[model samples]
Target: MKRIAVGVALLLMAATSAIGAGYTWKNLNPIAVGT
Candidate 1:
């Protein structure tokens, strides 16, 4: 039970961090860049 809780906590942390970073990128530039 404790291990499962820890795993979920870590997963949430990782997901939030990724989302935060991704949001930064997207907000900064949501433009398609290719030529």
Candidate 2:
């Protein structure tokens, strides 16, 4: 049970990080191209 909880937490963290990175790139790409 403990291991399962830890695994879920790690998965959520990774997913959030990936999403954040994608958004950051999306926000940056237009400005980067414009420049």
Candidate 3:
């Protein structure tokens, strides 16, 4: 059970990082294109 919980936590962290990176890319893309 503890191992399962840790796995889930790591999965969530990875998902969150992926989402944050996409969000940051979206926000930056326009400025990058404008330049």
Candidate 4:
């Protein structure tokens, strides 16, 4: 059970990290604050 839990955790981390979306998101941040 511990091994399975560890594997799932690793997969989730890898997937989350792989989500780049190729966006900087800085533009949206400045716009939201009226900068």
User: What RMSD value applies to candidate 3?
Assistant: 3.1
Q: Model 3: which ten-residue window has the lowest total lDDT?
A: 26-35
Candidate 3: residue 10 Cα off by (Å)? 0.2
Question: What is the lDDT for 32 in model 3?
Answer: 73
Q: Model 4: clashing residue pairs?
A: none
C-alpha TM-score for every candidate = 0.72, 0.81, 0.78, 0.55
lDDT (tens digit, per residue) of candidate 1 on 1-35: 99999999999999999999988877777683221
Question: Candidate 2 deviates by what RMSD?
Answer: 3.2
lDDT preference between candidates 1 and 2, better one: 2
Rank all candidate structures by their TM-score, best first, as comma-separated numbers: 2, 3, 1, 4
Task: Give the poorly placed runs of model 1, Cα more than 4 Å off.
Answer: 32-35
RMSD of every prediction: 2.5, 3.2, 3.1, 5.3
Which residue pairs show collisions in model 3? Answer: none
List runs of model 4 lying over 4 Å from the truth: 21-35
Q: Pick the candidate with the highest TM-score.
A: 2
lDDT of 4 by residue, 1-35 (tens): 99999999999988776664323354456675465
As a whole number from 0 to 100, the lDDT of residue 26 in candidate 1 is: 76
Quote the positional error of residue 13 for candidate 3 in Å: 0.5
Candidate 4 TM-score over all chains jointly: 0.55
Candidate 3 per-residue C-alpha lDDT over 1-35 given as tens digits, one digit per residue, 9 for 90 to 100: 99999999999999999999988887989787568
lDDT minimum window of 10 residues, candidate 4: 19-28
Candidate 2 C-alpha lDDT tens digits along 1-35: 99999999999999999999988887889787567
